[model samples]
Target: MSVRAHIIHAVTTSVSVKLMRGQLAYLRSKGVDLTVLSSPGEELVAVATQEGVSYKEIAMQREISPIRDLISLCRLIVFFAQKKPLLTNVGTPKAGFLCGIAAWMTRVPNRIYTLRGLRLETSTGLKRAILLLTEKIACAVAHKVICVSPSLQARAVSEGLVPLQKTIVLAGGSSNGVDTSRFATANIEKHTDLLQRHNIPPDAQVIGFVGRLTKDKGIVELVEAYQALKNEFPHVYLLLVGNYENGDPIPDEVKTVIKRDTGIILSGFVRDVVPYYTIMDVFVIPSYREGFCNVAIEAAAAGKPVITTNATGAVDTVLDGVTGYIVPVKSSEETRKAIRTLLCNPELGKEMGQAGRRRALNEFASPVIWDALYQLYGELINRR
Candidate 1:
């Protein structure tokens, strides 16, 4: 069978494409003709070259702009009709909604909607209703709906967005499994220069957080917790490895603390985060919502103990008291306590980190996940 697939997303530089990088290349190697579509940028060219796949640029906005969205839908419909791909997988909110509709209208053989997360979980009033409607529409148009985590699947089913039978969590629960070899503990020595550049003392204990510096990520609480922890452990440094998003702005007080604190290091929008993970002794993601905390697994693969909130997807990522600790959502005191526990007991932290690495190697390896996804695609196409 001649199988052709198209993966669509709103932005080229975003996590959706990053997560699919290895999987896309692996699929291509297995004789699947692959094409990627996103808004045009230098990253689009880079991704196409890296993945060894054809790429088409479609200008799609992340926001709900009716005129632009209509243009994008028309373009996608024409593209799908002409290409007639065997499968089209749409991800991210805007692209999923628009491309799902387009693929459905063009009668694509296998329409896949990757429900990364429920934006409605954090929204309210009319906004929540609108998000719910769009989610329903996206799922309704697709033949298969892949949730990144089981909790997200349950949430969708409970919310009446999609039936349980229509959705599946691929492999265990990660959009992209962690690259264990790349994120392994061996890279720590190699990143000594990076530590020097950042003025991070070699003996300093590091608590790291990676992802957008937005309100929903619990950045405000994290900052407050870090301040409390700093009073106890002066040697502990907070390493934040992401840029701030304008959509969900963090409080001014948090921004002020970030700017004033000498112990806090912010590496804005890094391309390669493996080295950053290497320097961290403990990784923390106090997110209020997530499809799955990819960085948490990446940190685990790097042999660092994790401390994340008991949020839907996040809770699934870390096995509490085994690989890491899970505190209640929005609790700064609880977050501080978790951090202190890890920091105080160095041996315990090391043990947990080792356990996390083992778990990552066994369950969340990239090759394992890629193979599963490839097989699923074959199954999906053959069924069609």
Candidate 2:
């Protein structure tokens, strides 16, 4: 079972490394020599220690900066030349583009660009054109492109970002599959302390959302939907588990509502989201786009019915009407209707939750995805 290959994975920022939580360790256990490269931060240091892997820090920027980007590219080329890794797998828009070129320049036998999401999907005019060009360049230099979800893969091909032959979706559709055991339903008593700390009433039905509270995440629509239902459903509480981001900021008016609304409890940036999921009766992710909505699957693993949009990765997370309802992106009315339906018919929500849990266990388990990825890597390395 020895995999005598050296592989380096890169992302733009340290926080983005959370997307691959247990994945690098899994690859290491299968005997692949692994190294993580990202911008310098405590999270990166922590990941290196926790996963028992070597790491390199490169100050990569998320935004377009011509001067800094050129400097970063030069550094990447030097790093690749020094490491000479058998495979270079890079993700995040910035890292993917730079590392793809660096890996190609250094003649890395297996180059991979992990297509997380297409920012151009939401951009327009000049910005959209720039994003599209960068995506194509990243894909052009990489030997393989790993789209996290089936829909994302299809979108990449449809948009001509990458050819069908160069892209793949491992197992079902997730970057790192859900840790079902950690996210499953917990003892009611075990959640009491967390509920009390958050000041959530025990009898209140919670509608939860996780991930950044940004414009693209459809936070404005989520707020609108919750406000619409608030009067009719007095006991229903909206709990947002993540913090706001400066980039793609939500409308000021929407932010004001989220803060002023008595029913909405904002729990900014939690390390352990599993506990929060246990407190939720139903989960909602109204994102406009995603590579794959990990939180939606995590909610499913927690045995909660999910309401997400038909946007790329989000669309694949739930089985419409079965595991959860699928609403159109940015439709507050539809989002509100879906929320009301679940809140009114508790039994239907329970049924959907159970079905979602079954789907999570059967299709999106971590080991299943890790094994699939390992096999793919093995095939690629052997070809080299």
- Work out the TM-score per prediction: 0.95, 0.97
Query: CA lDDT of each candidate?
Result: 0.85, 0.90
Which residue pairs clash within candidate 2?
none
lDDT of 2 by residue, 1-384 (tens): 235889999999998887777988998888889999999988888987899889999998899999999999999999999999999889999999998999999999999999999999999999999999999999999988999999999999999999999999988988789887786444312376777998878899899999998999989998999888888988889999999999899989888888888889999989888788888888999999999999899888888899999999999999999999999999999999999999999999989999998999899999899898888888898876
Q: What is the clash count for each candidate, in the order shown?
A: 0, 0
lDDT of 1 by residue, 29-129 (tens): 88888888887776677777898988888888877789988998999899989988888888888888998998899898888888888889989999899
lDDT of 1: 0.85
Against the correct fold, how does model 1 do in TM-score?
A: 0.95
Error of 1 at 223 (Å): 1.2
User: lDDT of candidate 2?
Assistant: 0.90
